[model samples]
Target: MVGSCSVRFPINLEYLHRTHPHVTTYEPEMFPGLHYRMVVPKVTFAIFKSGKVIITGAKNKMDIDNAFNQVYPILKSSIKITEIL
Candidate 1:
């Protein structure tokens, strides 16, 4: 499966839903953040079901990094930046 990453911050899940209609958004208490997974038929290496997206299971630095990278750009462009460190 292709991995993605993101920081803990505010985001408009609805917008993401619109862009990636097939994506599934979910929150798991085991992980300290939100998660989103989507399936694309064109992605040969995708492990998702034919039309299912799994957006959970980030439990380490690498997993977090992967999700952040995939979502940050979308967040940056679509959301307001109040502060940055």
Candidate 2:
């Protein structure tokens, strides 16, 4: 199956910075919150406020799903997965 979804997990800036050191972190005033930019092999992930995570530039769907699952527990019930453009 060609899985398509984006998962958002609630997390604080401190934790994100500590965990994904390889990813770049940016704070834009227009967004009015903190955000993270991560480039992992064949995928790119962007984490934003309200626990909204945007995963793009991926080579395949499985890679996105795996990344989502890996961070699923972090946000617990606050996690949300969207399967659409």
Q: Quick one: best TM-score, which candidate?
A: 2
Candidate 2 stretches with Cα past 4 Å from truth are 1-9, 30-41, 74-85
Once superposed on the true structure, which residue ranges of model 1 sit more than 4 Å away at CA?
Answer: 1-10, 26-35, 38-56, 80-85
* Residue 84 Cα positional deviation in candidate 1, in Å, after optimal superposition: 22
Model 1, span 1-85: residue lDDT tens: 3443233455554454456555534333343322445232222111111222233445555654555556457655435523321
lDDT of 2 by residue, 11-53 (tens): 4544555555666464554553344343443555555545566
The CA-based lDDT of model 1 is what?
A: 0.41
Residue 21, candidate 2: Cα error in Å is 3.3
**Over all chains combined, what TM-score does candidate 2 have?**
0.52
